[model samples]
Target chain A: MSISEAVVMNGGNGPYSYEQNSSYQKGVAAAAMDMIKEALPTTLDLYHLPLSSPNPIIRIADFGCSTGLTPIQAIETIVQCLLDLIKPIKEPRFRTLEFQAIFSDLPTNDFNTLFTNHLPVRRCYYAMAAPGSFHGRLLPTASLHFAYSSCALHWLSRVPQEILDKSSRAWNGERIYYVNSPAGVVGAYSAQFGRDMEMFLSARAEEMVSEGLIFMVVPGEPDLVHDSQTTLGSELELLGSCLVDMANEGIISKAKVESFNLPIYFPSEKELKQVISRNEFFHIERIQTLSHLKMHVAFPTPESRSLCLRVALEGLLCHHFGNELIIDDLFHRYSLKVAKSLFFLKPESHESISFSV
Target chain B: MSISEAVVMNGGNGPYSYEQNSSYQKGVAAAAMDMIKEALPTTLDLYHLPLSSPNPIIRIADFGCSTGLTPIQAIETIVQCLLDLIKPIKEPRFRTLEFQAIFSDLPTNDFNTLFTNHLPVRRCYYAMAAPGSFHGRLLPTASLHFAYSSCALHWLSRVPQEILDKSSRAWNGERIYYVNSPAGVVGAYSAQFGRDMEMFLSARAEEMVSEGLIFMVVPGEPDLVHDSQTTLGSELELLGSCLVDMANEGIISKAKVESFNLPIYFPSEKELKQVISRNEFFHIERIQTLSHLKMHVAFPTPESRSLCLRVALEGLLCHHFGNELIIDDLFHRYSLKVAKSLFFLKPESHESISFSV
Candidate 1:
């Protein structure tokens, strides 16, 4: 399947929906709000927005916004901050200026929930939903004033071709990720991330106005930490091991495990910085590393952790494996394993890297 | 129920969805396309649209667009006409202008089906979905350049209150619409349509630029035609009789039928002209009456007509009567009645009224 058709979070507000399981992303937005407020006046130059025009309309967009609850809080903060900043100005047109919030995601996104169920009752912006992939262009050229995204960029446009090819050295046999796989597998994932980032940055450059500001929160690994030492890496490895355990008993096939790799990569700050700097279209204002350990408070039990992971990955896993019973059995085994792996990885693996451009 | 929540059609591509049952609306749109193409150049002043601005973007909106199949065709024709008109002009900036299409409907609309399945594989405009009541402000002030709607304006914001008041002379105790009702009931329906159109026109005026163009295709009655002589009026009356038939047999209560009324009104050309003239924000360029009889080709059999009507009104009926079995039984009875109503209405009942402002 193409990347756009997959990679969708479970939709609607049911027990396993992305909406019900997205509290960690909400915490990520809350932690990043202070940086968003502090950086806007310096890097964004909010005072000179298009308040002088006759329409005086400002556009702010959130890309890869799944069902829009996470982006709603962040966008509300940005709009409220802008309104408060311009309150002291005597320009009547500044007071008349309005904001248009664009909530964008893949076309398969559940926009009915986004617009009807998640939008605030007393918000101060006109809401619109744009449905398309974010890896390429979605908006009009040079029409965006502010662009924001969170917990979305780690998803590669597609999994690496080399990891799926049996003849390649990067063939990830019996593994679903590059946790302790060969270096060639890691290199292939890193290369795919680089290419996707180039496309993402250039597309944003074309969509944003010359003086626009962008804020993003991405899953990332620290430069000195190994992949298997992070929380995300350890969890993925635990789940892959459980899949192999099932395959051994004929519950699933080994070839299925070898062929299905997660289309995700945790880039280091150094790697992300190098890509942004090479593009020459945007200057990285700051990269803040945040350990999102507080989010674990919402999922204290192993069952809760397993449920969150299931809600996030159940859609993709079902698409690959085509059996819900096997998935249920694997997650049950995986959660028990997660309960005992205290020495394998550090809690600092919950790091989220945020930046302004 | 609130107008924003209750005006929705049946969602998704199920057997009862509005998407599959709305071919008559498509025919209404196609019938209006010729007049749309002929009226644009002289009335709209399309050549001078923000072509020289740094970020040249033109926005077009469709209010009351259910799942956007009807507007997709109309919007494509409009964009192609604009592109062809600008091709002969020797200005480079005119070629740089882009179009943005906004599809507006009630909050409960099925936007997932709209943006995912109905959008063209290749189209010129960037598509966006706006969810809210069109009777109030939705877009930013003066942000719209063109506005369009077809077969949608006849829907009132809500059912008229006088029709539900027990003591009022206009109370429609046994009927669901003003067909063959008393003069007081007809007057009450007309007054409600006038008020709803006032709110609709003023909201568009605030959202549209001074030079923007507005086009609408509304279900309408000729001045000489009686309420019992039109297809829509006769069909609605037939359904109401079906409800009364069930109520007499104790299948449902009389109070439930007494309190229920369809939230719709079809105005005469004289009434529409008077309302538009009183708004003062827009000038009516022309009003052309069209008989959309070709839509019958798609619904030749009584069963086909029954299914189409069921898909269009099942949600509203189920909400009022609160039983799916009753709705199915009502439609079953009404379809047989429609097949026998040979002397009640003429084939000319299939009329649509279009106007440009």
Candidate 2:
């Protein structure tokens, strides 16, 4: 799925609507804050010197700032780091330092909460909402000192429509990246991802001051094509089957459902580094996978398992499964099946990555 | 680490081990033999029939099965429906089919790997491992029928203490369970894994004439955790500092290293269920977790990250900080300062399970 679609799907009232809710979103914000707090020291060690110089004010941006929570977290961490750095020095030295923070996301994202709710609480920091997809036009050249994003970069704009067609049989039970999805669809998605990544790095490169740091958390697999279990293909298959079943039951038309696809990608660690390396300005300082985080949120119980499946389907699956199916019934049945499946379903092995450049 | 140590550290190795060169372990094994091919379908559907029968052959067992691989995976998808039957079938058709598969681990295990590896596999089979470590003695009341086990459950005896404590850490890096170890060690090792799991399960249950099946796959997770990045806690911290200087000097720690931990676990989906459920006479159909399987094999790359230290040392740092430092180098240095934090590590997840009874 594409970033835009993920935002829209996530934004729409769905099972994962909790992610958009203020309370649940606060957890995300808090987690991001914790991550940033943990990452800031090294980030400062690398970028602080360049940023604190008598040069033009250093600008920083957060790409794919969904709900603007991660940026808020980053801002909070940076603020704390800056306070600590400046507190040790004289007031005169602190007065000479200038910093600007910018948050960017899809034009459709909600930034009001960030400005009205989060920014006002902090002092001596400037925040702005730069509207546009991170993959598209969003920032100016050499305008940023550092960049940060979390749990948002892997979103694609939309599901590949071709995969949903009945004739395509892309939704078959086989666990794979499309039941023979045409090279074109796969290429389009790959190119779009590559393009988005290039845009992300290039945009950051252009916007970031020399020797700037970029810390991001993205979902990834270890091996790309070789690992079937890590791929979303199986989940997609289950989702497709759910949708097809709905369509067959006359709950929704096949046509309406044939144009949707999932918009997320879990890149492998190799794939992530390869993308980062493509941009010369960003040097990787560290990269690691957080396996437990995903596990912590998964399959707490049979009900929770169904809830996750429903959330995944409604928020991400519908975009790929098409909208023709009666989402409510499909979700109900899907939840039942999921609950049943949970009885037999083994624990999921999920991995996430945190990287800094 | 040897199987014994792994058993101690992470619980016990589940089920059996495969001969590294076993043809039955290859992908071609299914095509090579009808028995193997039929194993999954027949065992998977076994629960669909009644349990009691005039035929007097309901109990089943998979002997010499190293950590029930085939059984759990085959039965997980269908175990729940099998367990909810309200009435026994007439003619006792398959009613006597009280199925159980006992998984045996070394006496030293805390049941960590069994829990990590076999538990999920059991969940898949809508079953749970018989609580408690499967070593020493099996329960005396149960009877097992149709026993089977592959490559593993055949280690001759214990891994030699000298080899385990070898002065060279590299010695631990070698695949001791296979050809790399001495003939005596291999024979002794193979026989032990076999005898332990087999004798333990067999003692608890009796064999039946109903023609049960046991299929297994072993010789797994070859990538032992030995590389510098895999080590965590004080060990990892020391190594990281050592590596920084080593990299500066262009030297590798080829020597001066002593023993390292392997943290190995076995119990393919089949063996876990078979051994733990005690031939299903005690009510367990499947058990497995595959996430750890892939995880155990995944090597950390520069781009991949590890959180082992944070998880392992969070408490230690907290104790020293004594609430004076909300976040400090003690916690953030390795995590944030050196760029060697949990943020960059990427480890694979495992999944396994079994089904019976």
Per-model DockQ? 0.71, 0.00
Lowest summed lDDT window (length 10), candidate 1 chain B: B343-352
TM-score of chain B of 1: 0.92
User: For each of the candidates, what fraction of the native contacts does it recover?
Assistant: 0.89, 0.00
Reference-based TM-score of each model: 0.94, 0.42
On lDDT, the leading prediction is: 1
State candidate 1's DockQ. 0.71
| Candidate 1 CAPRI-style tier | medium
lDDT of 2 by residue, B203-307 (tens): 444322233333433433223422222222223444244334433453423232222222222333343444445433334433222112122233233211223
lDDT of 1 by residue, B1-357 (tens): 454376677778877787877777677777777777887777767665543267677888989888847777878888887777767888666767888889998877889888777887567889898888888899998778889987778888888898889899988889988988877888888888889989999999999887888898888877767754454576688788988899999999998889888888888788889988888798888887864544456566666677777876776777677762377777788778877775223444454344333
Ten residues in a row with the worst lDDT in model 2 chain B?
B14-23
Q: Which stretches of candidate 1 lie over 4 Å from their true place?
A: A50-52, A227-229, A291-295, A323-326, A343-357, B1-3, B50-52, B227-230, B323-325, B343-357
